[model samples]
Target: MSRGLLRSTAVFSAMTLLSRIAGFARDTLQATLFGTGGAMSAFIVAYRIPNFLRRVFAEGSMSMAFVPVLNEIRERGDKAALKDFVDHMAGALCAVVLVVCGLGVLLAPAIASVFTPGWALDQPDKFAWTTQMLRITFPYLLFISMMSLAASVLNSFGKFALPAFTPVLHNLTLIAAMLWLAPQFDIRPFGLAWGVLIAGALQLVLLWPALGRLGLRPRLRAGFHHPEVRKVAKLMLPTLFSSSVAQVNLLVGTVFASLLVDGSQDWLYYSDRLIEFPLGLFGVAIGTVILPHLSRRHAATDAVGYSGALDWGLRLALLAGIPAALGLFLLAEPITATVYNYGKFEAFDSRMTAISLTLMSLGIPAFMLSKVLSPAFFARQDTKTPMRAALLTVAANVLLTIAFTTPLWLYKVEGAHGGIALATALAGIFNAWLLWRYLRRAGLLQPQPGWGRFSLQLFAACVVMATIVVGLRLWIGSWTEIAQPTHRIFWLFVVIGAGALSYAATLLASGLRPRDLRH
Candidate 1:
């Protein structure tokens, strides 16, 4: 890898690590305060609806369409054309996001009714809290969408550190709110919602200085009719459908989870959060840094560069993802207990959540690989193919959910959360496979030599990590009479540290080196 790409990846990875840590703190706070109950479920539902929209409009569709085109314009056009295109797109996106958010705020109750009807029926107070929280946080969707646009521009300009680190600001703000401000208001969970809005504003403000540094001062322009703007709109439509399908499937799962039991949504939410920590840290950071580089290489017809970038991304994904999946699977119980076994979160809740976490870990690699691979299509501007794949994945997820849930419901499984986790994992694997096949068929992705060796080494590392982690957990379990939380946390760290050291030693012994991570 070039020093520039490595530097960018490292910077982004560090920032992502901090953000994920803060996110864990935030989740820990939520788990303690709300536990596996109606309030937590309502909060998850409220937060998810807008977040789902953010993914569709802001993170997924908009960035995928805007970044490559912006890069192309920057390469071909003058400063004036670039500024005009950004201004027009920004204004148009702001208008659309504002309108949608307005509708969301106004119809928060009704929207909540449809997606989380069980909450509305059984826990009126929880439903009301969710409605109000949604009203406050809905506007964050608009601000963050604009932030996504600005960040994409900066990233295309190769100024990745600022945009990548800006998320840390959001996480910090939420952590502060949860620790300090929320208690002052007696609406602890609601305070987190307010923190989200403030964080979005902060993220946008942070990027504005970066935009100015890039000689781009965005101003509202009546240029929706601009041809370039229209092109972005045209590209975004299919991508939106593609992106929203995944969100829709998740929302459907949430609905089913709501009906399952009181704490089911919370269990699923916590488990998903655990898996998402690594996914966000490595998968998202790598994807963000790799996309523009891949797009540029594809645009320049640099086949070797494109292939190298893909290879490095896949290799890095395996290096980071496989160990994470194994660690989560083996230490799910201890990790959950150590992080979240407090306040209203009891032993039973931790056990249930650990079960879900273990099941979800099985799909971590598949999920990360999908994140890494989908960009191959996006870089080539072939959104239609991924859209088809995404739709098919959603259908498969729905069918699998029904299939799995039926048996679990019939047998009254101890933690019925396993079915949801399994369904999601199966769907994710399907999604990854379809994307890989499509990219290969389109000639956008090619298999590299030594993949067999990479797989073998990775498998060996996972085996070593899993064996140590499981043995350590068994040893710790035998000493359950340890009275202090400090003792528990200390032993947890010892086991985790030893397992990590073993994995690292095994990887090094197998001939994988830090240099292999470079492009």
Candidate 2:
């Protein structure tokens, strides 16, 4: 059982790594060509509003609600019922997204005003660009939402590869759009908005045929009044905020960031992207693979199996998240300067980006832990607990943002946006602790043996790894001074590779074995 779960996660992570590599290229090109200027900031805001909703309505809340119920119906051996439920779900999801997308297009200007009222007032051109791009990108919610439904069905059916690779195509499309399509448009950056719309439809189409292979092609049936449909909608409500706390907090940060400099939003967006690398590679892969497993274990009343899966997820989270956080925090400046300090992106922009990236790196372990913990509640169809956690976390984030950023904004301090990153990190840690305490109180998480030894091994490994990385950084000074970009990239790899190997060797030398991870 451990091997199966590990294999699935490995497969998913490998595919996601390719997508991340593609995304790296996309961002490198985007930063080089556009830089963190008024135009790119406009694109970031327009893209973010829809992307945030995609997480809320499509990937985050929607998947958590739909998967366990699908597992339940599958457990009961009810093919007809499953088909009926899926059809109604498709129609119902589409029906709602259509209206939402329509309203989004109609109110693009007002919506942009709300998120960035500062821009609307101070930079009217940026605001107009935001409204224009938003009108193009708003329909992406409908396409990506349907694609998520298809992905949920495929995941439950144990076909993980196709859905995992869809993002590869998504990124590739955007890269092509930037190179070829951007110049063709009147406003060159409008091509990025068009790229999003095209990519969403392409991904949905890519996943649709896979469902037919499983005999689960959903023929749309608007059974909004259907009991199962209503059940899913009800299950979806609390997760609306709970499953997407990070995104909600970032959106809040966007509001505050608008008051800073022109490219403040771009800096936050790029730094958050850096934070998501290990997160998408390991954290998301582990969470996605385990949720259905936990749901099935719960359906069978196999408490032992459920606990074991949670334990595995928790251990893996710490194993990957800690080293990732340390690496990002230690190398934030070099990494930023090497990748993005070309074309229009200047040293000033790199410095600003590194500030936020360093602060946000502190939240990696917490973000990963919450990813594992929230699924524990959702697997049992208990969404309200995480929702409560979500509410407090966001509230705390707002208060913290105000406390942290207001003083900086008041004083006209440089890099004021880092305060937003700091608040987001602190709130994430608070949320993870709350969920951990809730799970203990509810008696859902029974810690397996060796937690003490396991934690110690991780601590020792990280300490060794950090020492090596810092020494290397101090020896190889002045990353941005290298005339050749390839030289900088090569040295950066050398540093990362050494740290990774040092970490693994320390673990093995400390008596940690591969078999320990499996069982």
Candidate 3:
């Protein structure tokens, strides 16, 4: 990547790290306050419904489509047209999502029933809570989706940090709600749902001033039939699946998990959160920065810059993603036990969460690869190929979920939810492979030289890091057996820090350098 782009990515990643830290605090509070089984599972169901779709239309597909066109407009140097497009898109998205939110709120019970039919059948109380929370949280899709639009605009203009930092407010809001508000409710999970609602609106509000500073504050002129608007609409249709394949697979797991034991949903949800930490901190930052860079490169017809950016993103993603995956897989138990096993969240819950976390960690590389690869397609306005790949990936996910989870369910496996996670991981690998294959076949991605050396260095570092982490982890015995939560937390960080230092040292010794990442 160019030095400027690298700086932007770093800015975004640093801000994302703050947000992720805040997110850990929020998750810890939620686990301690709400635990896993009944109402937390209900909240997960309700939250995932809208949140998954938010990833689809907001950060995933919509930005993929919007950024390229927005870059095209900006490249034309027509400020009026640029502002017009932003305003119209703002109004159109708001109009559409408002209608969808209304429908979601109205259909809350039916939506809840569809996702958790088992709850409806046997656990009516959980079903009712799902519906209630869904009613409260559905509108989050509207607010957060708009916030993403604002963020996309900010990113296209090279203002990465504000957009990246906005998520911190979201985490803080939830933390506050859990700490102060949850205790007031007769049913505390209601506080979580309220937090979701408030966070969405607050995040959007938080970005408004940043938008104004850019002279791009949307005035909300509805223009669905406008040519640019129609083009974005056309693009969004295919990406509905293509952009959010992982989230789609997770929703599939959620549906299947509903039929399993009570806490299966929570187990899957918490494990997914753990895996998302690395992804959000790095994979997403790469994707977010690269999209606009690639879009501008495409608009300028800079093939060399485009390919270099793609190459750089792939190399960086692997350097961070592979080791992160291995580290998470190695430390799943300690990580889960330290982060979650508290208050009402028992050791069994932590153990179950670790099972899923370990399995899901396998998908991190594929997930990060797709993060970069999908944007390569989207940057060039080529959504169809990824859409086709996404279709097959999701189909494979469903089949694999059944194949993996069915036997676990039949045999009465203790952590049947882990099978759902394993299937998702495998499906993600398939999805990334498909995207990579598509990119290669199209002759759009030409790997820069030294890839073989890069691969070897990554492998060497991972092996070294894994050996050290495992050695220390074994020496420490078990995380759940630790007497104090603080002690467990302290040791987990020690192991993680040592592993990170070893990985970086090995990489440096193997001839990987900061300069190599720049060019």
Highest lDDT against the true fold, candidate: 2
Report how far off residue 159 is in candidate 1 (Å): 1.9
Model 1 CA deviation exceeding 4 Å by range = 1-3, 184-187, 244-246, 410-412, 478-482
TM-score of 2: 0.99
Clashing pairs in 3: none
lDDT of 3 by residue, 479-514 (tens): 899979889989999999999999999999999999
- Cα lDDT, all candidates: 0.82, 0.93, 0.92
Stretch of 10 with least lDDT, candidate 3: 1-10
lDDT of 1 by residue, 70-92 (tens): 87777776889999899998888
Cα RMSD, each candidate: 2.0, 0.8, 0.9
By lDDT, rank the candidates, best first: 2, 3, 1
**Backbone clash pairs in model 2 (N, Cα, C under 3 Å; residues 3+ apart or in different chains), count:** 0
lDDT preference between candidates 1 and 3, better one = 3
Supply the global lDDT for candidate 2. 0.93
What tens digits encode model 2's per-residue C-alpha lDDT throughout 384-456?
9999999999999999999999999999999999999999999999999999999999999999999999989
Query: What is the TM-score ranking, best to worst?
Result: 2, 3, 1
User: TM-scores for all candidates?
Assistant: 0.95, 0.99, 0.99
